[model samples]
Target: MLYFSKMDGRRWEPLQHDNQSTVAADFRLRPKRRIVPCRPRSLYHKRSITMATTPRNPRSKSGNKPAVAAPTGVIPVYDSALMQERRQRILDETRRVIEENGIESLSMRELSKRANVAQRTLYNAFGSKDRLVGLVIQETYLTQLSRMKFATAPDTMEGVIERLARVCMHFGRKRNYLKAVMDLYFAPTVHRDTITMMRELSYGNSRPWLLQLEQRREISPFLSREQIEGDMTDLAFSVMRKWAIGDIGVARMADEAVRGFLVLAAGATTGEAQARALRTLALRKRRAAGPATAVEAAGMADMAGVE
Candidate 1:
């Protein structure tokens, strides 16, 4: 006698056994048996088979598996309003902490305590300490940049001087905090993303005005926008760095920045614009020839006004 056993529900295989095992045997050969559907022996067997064939739910209450991940390119939304509020509070506290204690003294635990948020929440929102610091610096710069109402004025060499003066005044107002931030921004070990973001912010703010100047023919058509912007940015940053490091006062920083920009612009401008740049450069040099008192320096800064 030949018998078959169910393999998976779809197929069966022949089972061989000795005569003593089953107590029966067919000595004569017979035709091969046809395959038939398997039938469960009892309700318990049927239930077991059904359970074995069914797919499992990852999020089922009876299973320990985690919930399925969101589909590709799908972002999960959370409590947006509350998260924004929390982020704002954290940023405010971060600015205060960095301003009072400097970046080197900023502790995540202390910041969390100050902001009344969990340490994990900080990491969740900003990813890392370097990122949080970058955010604070970026926010501060943007806030100051936005406050310069005169920034929207006509793009001219005078407008450029005014903008640099405004920037210097902004830095002067937040000297302690910005100095520390600038230190971190220029550090050799600073995070690449943070530095890249800082540079992009600088470039983005300047490019539009530079482009406008180019369009009006205030900037020379021979000069590429990138070259003009790059040179001006480098000069501005060098002067700002000197101010941040206490090597120069805000007045001198503004004067130097304006002078440097004018020198570069003079080379890249034509017609009346070139003449204006050279004239401004000469005036700035004459003003810087003598050592001025605090009041005089302040007056000079006021003269190179933003509006």
Candidate 2:
């Protein structure tokens, strides 16, 4: 059976046709609109492209997990200490070259020379310059988070502030690392997707740990957990942006950050732990003349032959 359709602008009017197949063939030959087959829902979930109307999961209303949980369960794979050291070397070098010459001028040839690793290692570790930078930033961010962990203040309010304060001070020493993070966070068009992942990892991984911060003696009892969470987030971004643009010196960046954080977090009854941590941090800053190389600051007396 064949049908003829006459188009009047956007409207189509059906007409009687003796040969349906012939009319259909003619219609196919002259397409009025392009028709494309949609990919299966499984394929869409696999790609993980987020859209406003894209139902992340058909089964889950909250869209918690995708239709399928990602392999490895959204955590880092276990690697031996030796493997971690090797990767850390690659990351440190990647940070050095990119900061020295900017991301645009970065080359594997130069990175290979500077990073003190074989060119193939760079290729194997990260597939491309973009990914190399991404991993470098990710590793640096993770390092800060790792340093924040505390046995004493597992989930206390003072403990949370103390951890945040310590991490801020630690990162404030690494000029190269700080510059690279600022670049990644601010460079939207250059590395948008990588930026998204970095932020997600930063916030997502810390949420569970943040529950410990609630109702701490150092934090305002007047503030709700929701308010504290929102304020801390904005404060972190503000400090980073200020440091990125060179508006604040390294020591002051950390100082004002911790102080400002204390002010925001301070409750009527300030804990001894909070007061003691602040004193220790301030003393460390005063003892140091200025920012030193990552190696030197680590109390590494010599970094002989390191690129």
Candidate 3:
């Protein structure tokens, strides 16, 4: 109904299509609010921009201005439960490592990994691998200590000697533990710390047992308390040394030697000289029964018959 007219060709525009076609038909649609982009700024903050760069704690060496507490190394702090669990875990892992690879193979990182703990935890708890080895020795000593059944009760000198023998034999049976001790002994200068640590730990762990052993008058008759203490300590370490060196084999001679030492220590002359006399008599009998030429034995027998 209108006349056709020519317009300016310079003006152009694109047709707008519904955006809903791009969205899934089943999807629920909502009108979105338009958002204007802006740079974030907090208005409530009081400090000026220059004040932030100036440093609030200008007097402190750290320059934080507010100041923080410094740590003191003089006092030792420990969490008892964490320490207990960590110690036990380390010990268990150490034993396993010693059994699997050998004592020399127990590296700090390897041990930490084996124990499922961090290497720092091990260093913080034990200082070094040498100290860790020392703790392992302590664990071994504790295990052996537990097997000593006669620490409290004693009936006779023979019983005490038997108990000592049993303890020595039981310790030697644990080959890995003996190897660990030997390793501690021969470890390099840096590792020697563990040896000294073990000496202290061993002496510490034995204090109570040694006290109980001293109370037995039948075990130490002539030796004064101090003398007995020194002797017992020496004897214990001597046996440990022997065990480390693998010197005590399955021989009756070692047992007899141990028995003789116990007899001497217990002062058999005081209460039971008769036992020693009987031992001497048995020795004499064995000497008389020694193997010899038949003619020589007969000649000696005939001379004895003439006498």
Candidate 4:
């Protein structure tokens, strides 16, 4: 007799037989096993598991829910009415300090104290002292520049001259503050943003007036709008800078600015506009020379009488 073992899927099973023929017959009587393929887990299933495990409202206490917290790292927008009033107050105080004590005397500590704000608030609002002063200049000086009108004068070249004269007068009224501002403006280490803001304010205010001149055909067709506007703006700024630096009196600044404008306009006009510009320049030159000529002639007469 012989006995054999065979695997029956889960375990081995013994076959009892009397001979080798019986053992082969027992092995053929075993049943076959079936296999089933496995399916993969899905994204939704994983998320469901995560949600089931995570605590809902982790920060909330038992029974009552906590208030939602504000998101971190968000910058605040400064355009609200309250923020605008605060900003205006800060600017007004800055202007007052600069006008009363000069720009050199201005300090963030003093300004904050005067404005009833923390020193950190000043830094947060303006980033730096240069920026604060630049804003003051823009708000005070540039605002006036933008509001200037030729109510009495027509939309002609003469109106432009009057506007320049008014600008010189305005600068003269704030000599101390403007002088300091000019020094800072021309400094080698001044912030580029400050320079850009000042330049843009000037150029922006001038553009509308220049556009009016262009529409009226007072500006030359040969020159681009940019060329005419830029030339005139540069001339006006140069004159104002001279006045600000104490290099010239307000009267002289006005005269030089008017002359420069007329000269530039003369080259940048055609037809009747060109003739008018030339005539204005010639008349100014004659007026400027008249007194000097009279003085020289009087001196010569005195010399002859003495002789």
What residue pairs are clashing in model 1?
A: none
Clashing pairs in 4: none
**If the candidates were sorted by their lDDT against the true structure, best first, what order would they fall in?**
1, 4, 2, 3
Worst 10 residues of 3 by lDDT: 290-299
Poorest 10 consecutive residues by lDDT, candidate 1: 290-299
Report the C-alpha lDDT of model 2 over 247-276, residue by residue, as the tens digit.
987656655665555555443224653565
What TM-score does model 4 achieve against the real structure?
0.62
Model 4 ranges off by over 4 Å: 1-76, 142-149, 153-155, 204-206, 216-222, 289-307
The best candidate in terms of lDDT: 1
TM per candidate comes to 0.65, 0.46, 0.50, 0.62
Which candidate, 1 or 4, would have the higher TM-score against the true structure?
Answer: 1
**Cα lDDT, model 3, residue 32:** 38
CA shift of 262, model 3, Å: 1.6
TM-score head-to-head 1 vs 2, winner: 1
Candidate 1 vs 3: which has more lDDT: 1
lDDT of each: 0.69, 0.56, 0.53, 0.68
How good is model 3 by TM-score?
Answer: 0.50
